[model samples]
Target: MTVWQDDVARDLVRNVGDRLALLTRGEGSHVWDGDDKRHLDFLAGIAVNSLGHAHPVFVEAIAKQAATLAHVSNYFATPPQLALAARLKRLAGAGIDGRVYFSNSGAEANEAAFKLARLHGIGRNGVAARPRILALENGFHGRTIGSLALTAKKAMREPFEPMPAGVEHIPATIEALEAAIDDRVAAIVVEPIQGEAGVVELPEGYLAAARSLTLKHGALLIVDEIQTGAGRTGAWFGFNHEGITPDAITLAKGIGGGFPIGALVTFGVASSLFTPGSHGSTFGGNPLGTAVANAVLAEIEDAGLVENAARRGAQLREVIERIESPLITGVRGRGLLIGIVLSSPIANAVVAAAQERGLIVNAANPETIRIAPALTIGDAEIAEFETLFTAALADVQASLAASETEKATAP
Candidate 1:
C-alpha cells in the first residue's frame, strides 16, 4: 500500500472499503492521480459533479460567497438561501404553496422527509392515524438511521435491526404498489430510477399508477431524486417525465454540483406538514453552499447542459450499442446516468480494467457497470470514452477466454 492507503488503514473506519486511487486534482471531465496519470472521470463523483471538476463558475461562486457572508445559522436566512429555495421550488414545479427545507446531504434531506411522514401520520386527536411507510424492495435512499429504515436492502438493514418501525418494502411494479398501498400508509417513497440498483428504471406507468394510488389513499408520494435530479436524467428532475407532481421530493447530489447540500422540496399541503421545531440544520442553507449551487445551476441553465445531457446521452447509448462485445447485453437508464448490463458477473474486473486503461467507471452490481459522466461532456469526451471502454471490455473478454481455454485443455 502507498502512504495514503497506509494512513487510511491505520486511522480510518473500516466500514468503507479500500481506496481505488489517490486522485489529487481534477479539471473538466478528467482527474489526475497521485502518480500524475490522467483518467477520464465518467462517474463524476457518483453524479455529484454536475458542472465538472474545478469549474470556473463553481470556484468563483465559492470565493465570492466566502468573502461576503458564509454562515449566519438558520435563525436568520441569507439572500442566497432564499433565492435557492425559490429556484428549487420553481424548477421542481412545486407551485405557489411549495416550501423547501435545506440540509447538508441527501440522507439528512430524507431524514427530514421521514419526519414529514411522521407529521402526516398524526390525526386530529394527535394519534398516529397513518403508521405505515412503503419503499421499493431494492431502492436506496441513504445510509442514515432514518433514511436507512426506508431503504429495503436486507443486508444493509439486518445488522441495524430494531430499525425505526412501520417501514415496509414492496416490489417496483404498479401491481405491487396497488396491492401494498392503503389509507394507513402515511407515505410511499420511491426513486424515479433506482441508481444504486443498476440504474433500473421503474416499469411503465409505475409513477403514474403510484400517484393515483397515493392520491386515492391520501398518502404522500415522495420521490427520491438524489441521483436523478439536477438534469442528470435528461429532466430537471426525474419525475418531470411522468408529468405528475409528487407531494414531496428529496434533492441533493448534482443539485450542489459537487458541494455538500441537500433539500426536501414539498408541494401544496405537504409543505405545511413540518411545523416549527420539527426539523432544522445548522449549516444547511449557509450562504457559501447556496451561492455555489446557485452559480452551478445558473451555468447549467445558460449553457444548455440539460438539453446537452439528453442529446449526448442518446449518442452515448448508440455508440455503446455499436460496440461488438459478447459480454455486453444492453444498456439501461436515462440521460447521463447509464448502466452497461453484462452477460456475466465480471463487473469488478471490467472496472479495474477500465481504471488500468485510464478511464473511470464503477460496477453498480456484479453484472452492471454504471456510467455517469459530467453533464458538461461533449463529443470529445464521448469519443475518448468509447475507445477506452471498448479496450476495457476487450481486456476482460480476453481474460475470460484464456481462463476457459486453460480449463478445456487441462486433464
Candidate 2:
C-alpha cells in the first residue's frame, strides 16, 4: 500500500474499505491521480458532478458566495436559498403551492420524506391512521436509520434489525404495487431507475400505475430522484417522463453538481404535511452550496446539457452495441445513467480493467457496469469513452478466455 492507503487504513473507518486511487486534481471530464496519470471520469462522482470537475461556473459561484455570505443558519433564509427553492419548485412542476425542504445529502432528503409520510399518517384525532409504508424490493434509499428502513436490501438491513417498523418491500411491478397498496399505506417511495440495483428500470407504466393506486388509496407517492435527477436521465427529473406529478420527490446527487446538497420537494397539498418544526438542517440551504448549485443548474440550462445528455446517451448506446465483445450482453438505463450488462459475473474485473486503461466506471452489481458521466459531455468525451471502454472490455474478455484455456488444459 502507498502512504495514503496506509494512513487511511490506520485512521479511517472500515465501512468504506480502501481507496482505489489517490486522485489529486481534476478538470472537465478528466482527473489525475497521485502518479500524475490522467483518467477519463465516466462515473462523474456517482452522478454528482453534473457540470464536470473544476467547472468554471461551479468554482466562480463558490468563490463569489463565500466572499459574500456563506451561512446564516435556517433561522433566516438567504437569497440563494429562496431562489433555489423557487427554481426547484418550478423545475419539479410543483407550481406555486409546492414547498422545498433542504438537506445536506440524499439520505437526509429521504429522512425528511420519511417524516412527511409519518405526518401524513396522522388522523384527525392525531393517531397513526395510516401506518404502512411501501418500497420496492432491491431498492436502495440511503444508509441513515430513517432512510435505511425504506431500503429493501436484506443484506443491508439485516444487521440493523429492529429498524423503524411499518416499511414493506414489494416487487417492482405494477401488480405487486396494486396488491400491496391500501388505504393504510401512508406512502409508497420509488425510484424512476434503480441506480444502485444495476441501473435497473421499472416495469412499463409502473409509475403511472403507482400514481393511480396511491391516489385511489389516498397514499402519497414519493419519487426518489437522487441518481436520476438534474438532467442525468434526459429529464429535469425522472418522474417528468411519465407526466404524472408525484406527491413529493427526494433529490440530491447531480442537483448540486458535486457539492453536497439535498432537498425534499412537495407538490400541492403534500407541501403542507411538514409543520414548521417537523424537519430542518443547519447547512442545508446555506448560501455557499445553494449558490454553487444555482450556478451549476444555470449553466446546464444555458449550455443545453440536458439535450446533450439525451443525444450523447443514444450515441453511447449505439457505440456499446457496436462493440463485438462476447462478454457484453446488452446495455440498459436512460440518458447518461447507463448500465452495461455482462454475460457473466465479471463486472468488477471489467471495472478494474477500465481503471488500468485510464477510464473510471462502476460495478453496480456483479453483472452490471454502471456509467453515469457528466451531462456536459459531448462528442469528444464520448469518443474517448468508446475507445477506452472497448479496450477494457477486450482486456476482460481476453482474461476470461485465458482462464478457461488454463482450466481446460489442466483437465
Candidate 3:
C-alpha cells in the first residue's frame, strides 16, 4: 500500500511537491512529523508563525471570534476589521489619513497595491499610456498574474505569459533604477530585504536612493514587506529601518500569526485611489482573521517580541560567524531573517543532513540556507541549534572531502 506521502506526491499539484510533508505539527521552535519524530524548526512556517504554533493568545482569540462571528461580507464594517486597520496605520506612521484593504494572502495584497498604483496614475494619463511598474531583479512579489508579472525569475514565469501588462524589471541598484524610471512609470516595487532570494539585504542608502529616483520621476515607491513585515525584521516594517515612507506598503505572513490574511496600506495621496466599490474581499477582513491578528499584535507588543528578535538575531549571527567553516562564505540578514551563503552549491545537501539531525531548515537558493526562526524562540533553542548546525557542517565537510578524493581517483 502506498503511504500518505506517496499518495501526496502522486495526487497533489507538483508545485512545492514534497516540501509540504516535511513538518506536521509545531510548538514554539519545535515540530513533530507523522513518524512521531521531533525536529527543531528554524523555518517557522517560512516566518509566518511569529508567536509560534498553538499560542494561547491566538487560539483564544480565534475561538472567541469564531463563536461571535467568523466572517461577514464587505457590505458592512466590523469592529475587529476596523481595529486592525487602525493599528497597522499607526505602525506605518501613515498618520490618521491612511486607508486599508484586506486580502486573503500576500499575492492578493500586492495585487491590490498594483491596482491602487495604476489608478493613481490614471488621472494624469487618461488611461491611454498607462504607467509601467518597475520591479527589482531577483525580487519576488507574488505568484498571481499581476504580481507574478513583477517577479524576476524566468523559470517561474515563462509558462504564464500575457500577464497583466505594464510591468518591467530592472537591476537592484540606484544606477539601474535611475536609468529605468521615466515619466510613464507608475511605481517601483522592491523588497526591503529580498527574503526568498537568499535573504539579501539592501546596500546602505539603496532605499533612500530608490526613493529619490522615484520622487524625481514622479513614480510611486512600493515597498513589498510581505516577507519582512510584522516585526520579522526587528521593526514594525523593514523599510522603517531606512526611515523612508513608501507610497504603498504590502504586508502578510505573521501578521495574522499563521492565519491567512494580507493588507494593502496606502498613505496620503495614494489613499484615495480606491473609492467605494473599486475593490473588496468577501473574507479578507473577516472577524476571524482580524480578531486573531489583533491578538497577535497585542501579544507581540506585550512580550516585547520586536526587541527580543533584534537581540537574539544578533546573537545568532555572532554564533554562526563563530562556526568559521571554510565552506561558509558569509552570513547575511537582520533580525531573525538570516541567510548563510556557502562557497559551493551544497546547500541542499546541508538541508538534508540537518533534517537527519532532527532540525528543520531551508535552502533559499542553491548556495544559501535561509533561517527565519520564531520570534518567541529562546536561548536554549538557539544554543542547541548552533551545536547541531556546526555538527551538520562537519558532516558536509567530510562528505565533500570524500567526493573530491573519489573524483581524483576516478577511472
Candidate 4:
C-alpha cells in the first residue's frame, strides 16, 4: 500500500529542497510515481527524453548495444560511434566538412566547445595573449567549470568563483554583441533559444548578427543547441532555422533520448584545431551512447515527431492563449519548448496545482512555467494540457484572493 517516501536521506547535494515525487516508471508521455498515480509529463526530463520514457525503440537499441559492446576507450573506434558522428555532421549541414567530439552531458559538450574555441583562437590569429569568451546574459551552457564560466547566471556562477577565466557575459542584444566581439575574442556562444531564462526566444536575426560579427572579427561562433537541438525547435538544429552557420555547435539533452551523451560539432578550420593530444573523453563516443542516439534520431525522423512538435506546439500555444485568463500573460518559444508567462509570481503555486490535477509541469522561474513534453505528443494530449494549465492558473489565483481576504479580515 505504501512506497518509499524518499526522505532526502541520501545526503546528496542540497540545491533544491526535498523530493517532489519518486517516479517508478514511464511509458509514452505518462509516468507513474511511487504511489502509482499516473501523470501526464510535459517537462520530459528537462527536455532530455525526446522519445518519451522507456520508449521501446530506445530501450531495444540500448539493450542490443549493451549485449554487443557498451563501451570502448577513446583509443578505439566502433561502428555506432562513427555512424552516429557522421549522421550528426550531415544533420549539421554539408557546407563545412565537420568532425564530432562526444561527451557525457551538455555541460561537457560546452566544455569541449570552449576548449576548441580557445584552440581556434590560438590557431587562427596567433597574436592574442588569451582569447576572451563571450556569452549572452541569462543564457545557460552547462554547470562544469569551463562551461559554468560561460553561463550568465550570477547566482549559479558566484558560488564557485574564479571560473575558468577569460569569460564574460553580455546582454542578448545586437548592440552588446557588436561591442563585445573583436579579433582578440576566441568565441561567442549563444543558445539560439534561451532555455533556462524561462524559455525566452531570441530575437529574429540575432543569430545572423552573431555569425556576421564573429566572422568579421575572425572569432569562432559557437551555438549551444543543447536544449533546442534534436527536433525540439521544429528543425534538426535550431540554427538551421536561421539559415546561417556557426563555426561550432554544442549538442546534448535530447540527442540521446534519455541516455547521457553530448557532442561538439565543428566545421572549417575549427574542426581540425584539436590535434591528437589536445582533447579526449574516456566514456565519450562509446558504443552504447551512440547506438541509442542513432535510434532516437531514427524514431524522430520516421515518426515525423519534428513536424508533430511544430504542429502540436502551435496548438498548445493557441489553446492556452485562447483561454484569455487574466493570470496568463503570454506564451513564448518554438515547437514543443514553451513558456507560459504568468502575470504574478505564482508559477510555483501553479506547478503544485497542476501536479495535483495529474499533469506535471515546471515553474521555470518566478513568473514562468515551461512545457516541453515529448515531440511525439499528439493533439489530444495538448488539449488535455490546455485544460489542466488553465485550471491550475485559476486555482492558484483563487487561493491568492482567499489569502488576501483573510489578511484583510485579520488586520
Which ranking of candidates, highest lDDT first?
A: 1, 2, 4, 3
| TM-score of each predicted structure versus truth | 0.99, 0.99, 0.96, 0.96
**Backbone clashes in model 3, listed as residue pairs:** none
Candidate 2 per-residue C-alpha lDDT over 1-411 given as tens digits, one digit per residue, 9 for 90 to 100: 889999989988899855889999999999999999999999999999999999999999998999999889788979999999989998889999999999999999999999999999989999899999999998999999999999998888889888998999999998889888889999999999999999999988899999999999999999999999999989888898888999999999998998999999999999998887877788888989898888888898889988888889999999999998888999999999999999989999999999999999999999999999999898899899989999999999889899999999994
Poorest 10 consecutive residues of model 3 by lDDT? 16-25
lDDT of 4 by residue, 96-193 (tens): 47889999999999989989877866644566544688888998988889999998889999999988878889989999888877788988989988
What tens digits encode model 1's per-residue C-alpha lDDT throughout 1-411? 889999999999899788899999999999999999999999999999999999999999998999999889788979999899999999999999999999999999999999999999889899899999999989999999999999988889889888999999999988889988889999999999998899999997889999999999999999999999999989899998899999999999998999999999999999998888888988998899998888898899889999889999999999999999999999999999999999989999999999999999999999999999999999999999999999999999999999999999999
* Model 4 spans > 4 angstroms off: 1-7, 94-96, 123-130
Residue 252 of model 2, lDDT score: 92
Off by over 4 Å in 2: none
lDDT of 4 at 280: 86
Report every candidate's CA lDDT: 0.94, 0.93, 0.87, 0.88
User: Predicted candidate 2: what Cα RMSD to the true structure?
Assistant: 0.9
lDDT of 3 by residue, 164-273 (tens): 77888888887888888888888888999998899998788888988887788877888998989889889989998988988889988989889999999998778888
Comparing 1 with 3 on lDDT, the higher-scoring candidate is: 1
Clashes of each: 0, 0, 0, 0
| lDDT agreement of model 4 with the native | 0.88
